[model samples]
Target chain A: MVKKFMALLRMKYIEMFAYQWATLAWSTGAMVQPIITMMVWINIYETEMESFILYFSTLILVERLTAAWDVWDLDRDIREGSFSNYILRPIHPIHWAIAENIIYKGLFLVVLVPAWLVSSFFLPSLQLHLNGWEWMLFISALLLGGGIRFMFSYSCGLLGFWINKVTAVYAMFEGISLFFSGRIAPFSLLPPIMQDISLYLPFRYMIGFPIEVITGSVKGADLGYGFLGAFIWVLIFMGILGFLWHAGLKKNQAVGG
Target chain B: MSIVVDHLNKQFKVHVRQAGWLDAFRSIFKREYQIVEAVNNLSFTIQSGEIVGFLGPNGAGKTTAMKMLAGLLHPTSGAITVEGFIPQEQKAEYKKMMSLVMGQKSQLIWDIPPMETFLVNKAIYEIDDNSFNKTLDELVALLELEPLLNKPTRSLSLGQRMKCELAAALLHRPKVLFLDEPTIGLDVDTQEKVRRFIANYNREHKTTILLTSHYMGDVTALCKRVIIINHGKLLYDGDLDVLTEKLTPYKLLEVHLPTLPNQSWETYGEVDSIEEGKVTLRIPRERIREVSARLLQEFPVHDLNIQDPPMEEVITLAFQEKSHG
Candidate 1:
């Protein structure tokens, strides 16, 4: 099983390489929203302009790592009958999606790390003061956040098995996530009610909480809450993922190609 | 037996809607659905090492039956066991023992050479290195895929790609194979080659095969026993020759004469066609021998030949009879 997974991962990596330009274009496009948010906040918030800049820059990096677009691919596969290839095999189809997610993140990091480093030199406010333990927790939080986000999005994708167009559903979820997950503004900047809602929901753990951890904004008891929230959300999404996978397979039409 | 399907039935709940903006809009809230019986109470057993041709016209449930046997679709009611394993359960052991190749659907990775897909299948099926290499070598040699293995699947011709598809399906050495229109659109030469390859492979491996093809030549060449279905019901299941004989009771006899005879040819047999010096007659099968001898004695017969009706004609007649009833 491990050998098969590794092979799938390698195959996805090769496939990603074939679309290297498209990957670069998408990553570049992803940076624009965070950059625009930072620009607007810098002009409006005179007192915390530098800190906002630092936070949004880190948010861009974290967003790139945690993004999962497998729902679109899954929807297409179900509609076009390509999913039969995976179904006919001995392996579950989710492994292919997982491999694709891992490859996309790995390839994005290749273009991101160097860019982050070079931009940090130019942007003095980007520097962070983090202890060793804090750095470790931040890395762990990133992995958990990515996992939660992937499972959550993939669960939404599984809705394709029931509905004809999942994109509208995914778009609605994404629209809500954009505001609650700190894409447009920091969680602290939201209304207290919205902030409270974000803390309880999985969206904060998916993107914002991990960024807060790395930026030293979340610490002490809140740091533990951040980790716990992300871990619990991962567990919750994992449960939902299992149920959705079973139900989706049962409902699969296996429509003609 | 390699496969046993008893009282198998499959029904699909298809949404019924008429064209028009109002109906389409109303369907969103309260859609009407009709149940379509794709395979109805179908039953057949295929023995080990036996090649059976599954014959049907479009929408005849042949593909649906095959899908149920391959474990891709669940039967609404009935039982199907392939190689002593329940197919719908989709056990790994069962999957490893059988393979399905759909000529219309490709399992190969289009952007990469077929070898990559083969390697992936190797891992999925857990074929050991030695067995993988040996089986791949044999398949390559048998299918003449030496030159096509390295080219990207997208670049290969349709015939070349189909050979690779077959190789990919057989890499694990499955005991039972379900082929759905495996030679649908290939040229005549390529079709002949694929038919020969299937025959030789079946002979050597004793692998049971259930094939569905519209081309009668494919069925006639590789299969002796054929099971036919129409409207999700079994029409016939026995020897191909027997089905042909049962559906068509007449043989065609063409006689070439030194010149056009002055007498009416209807007295000999029903004149199907006549040109300058040749006349084709449809004669009853029982009187074929007697009529030929009499014709040889009665006229200046240059040459005479007797042939059974084509398999396509027999199958069409069978379907027509069933539909009319």
Candidate 2:
């Protein structure tokens, strides 16, 4: 099993590097979104660079670091039966999907690093309060956040097993996430009750939880509690996904129409 | 050491509907179903290292049976085992020793060269570098894939891509190969070449090859033994020569004489066709020798030949026998 996992990882690495040009294009596209958000916020705040610079830059940082691509790929795979190839491979195909996710994430960090540094320099007052322990906590939260996001989105992809076409459903989910996960605007800027509600929901933990860690709002015991919630949600995602996949497989075998 | 299939059956539940948006909408809430017995009570045993041709017409459960052996589909009520492993168990060891190649379906990465896909499989299979290189080199040479290996799969012609597909599927040197129409849609020369490669590869590696193809040419060329199935039931299973004799009691004889003989040929056998100086006759299998001898003596025979009834006819008869039964 260990050897097979290593092989899966190696295959994913070779695939990522082979398609390096497209990877570059996509990561560039990811960076551009945050950079544009940074510019728009700078114009909006104008003179008040204090909270504006800190919050906006941290938002961009969290977005870039916590990106997940499998949600989109997974939906397409389920639609076209490309997932059949994954199903037939000897090892559990989820490992390959996860390996692909890690590769794309690793590549995106490289793209975001220079942009992060340059953008910070341009915004002179931009201050990301970072110390060793806090930075380590932030990194952990970011990984957990990415994991939670993948699980939720992957479960969304599973909807394809029941529905003939899931594009409209997936699009609606995306639209909800754009607002719900603090992608378009920070949770605090929304109605106060909505922000508090997001804290318990998986969607906020997917995006908002990591950004909160980055901005230093989540500290001490809060960090541990937040992590516990994230892991629990991950477990929930897995449980639901397992039930759905088994049911879908039964349906597939019964008719195979 | 043997593939054992006993009373294996597959029933497909298919949605019944006709075209048009209104029908589609109505059918969504109120759908009808029809049961299709793709394979029923089919039983066969194939020892290791045997190359058997699995012959059937379209929608005749040929692919469904192959899928069962490959562990892709579950049998409805019967048992299928290979070397004591229930195939549907799909043990990793069982999968490691088996390979499936469907000619119409591809496993290669479309945007990249086939060699790249081979490398991916090499990684997935965890083949050591030395073995991977050795096997790849041998397959490339055998399939004559050197020139085609680096060309993107999308760029290669159908035949070229199929050669690559064959090589890719064979990289692990599987012990059992399930080939579904592996030479379908290829030119005659390419088809012949593929058949020769399969024969030579089976000879060298002693791989158990179960091939299903629409082309009778494929079976006539590669398979010495054939298993015939129709409507999910075993129609016949035995040596190809014996099958021809049992299923078709008659043989074809083509006569090319300098001129039409003055004597009536009906006394010799059933006359199939007569054109100009040529006459084709169908005679009972038992009477072949006597009929040929009599024809030579009676007619000024320039050239004469005896042949088995065409495979297409035998299959048609097999289906008729099946449906009637």
What digit string (tens of lDDT, one per residue) describes model 2 on residues A196-236? 77767777777777877877667789777888888888888
lDDT by residue (B60-132, candidate 2, tens digit) is 8888888788776778889999867887775777877888888877778777778878877887776789989
Stretches of model 2 off by over 4 angstroms after superposition: A1-25, A30-61, A71-82, A125-127, A158-162, A242-257, B261-264
| Clashing residue pairs in candidate 1 (N, C-alpha, C atoms within 3 angstroms) | none
Q: If you assessed candidate 1 against the hidden native complex, which CAPRI class would it receive?
A: medium
Give per-residue CA lDDT, model 1, range A1-257, as digits (tens). 89999989887877776676898887778999898889899889988988898898889889999998888988888877777778788888889888988888887788888887888798888767778988888789889989988998888888888887797898998999999899989887899999988989899998999888887878799889888888889889989999997777667677773
DockQ, Cα level, model 1? 0.58
TM-score of each: 0.96, 0.90
Please give, for residues B120-165, the per-residue lDDT of candidate 1 as tens digits: 8999999999999999999899889999988878999999999999
What's the TM-score of chain A alone for every prediction? 0.96, 0.85
- Report clash pairs, candidate 2: B39-B232, B40-B232
Q: Lowest summed-lDDT stretch of 10 residues in model 2 chain A?
A: A248-257
TM-score of 1: 0.96
- The candidate scoring highest on TM-score is 1
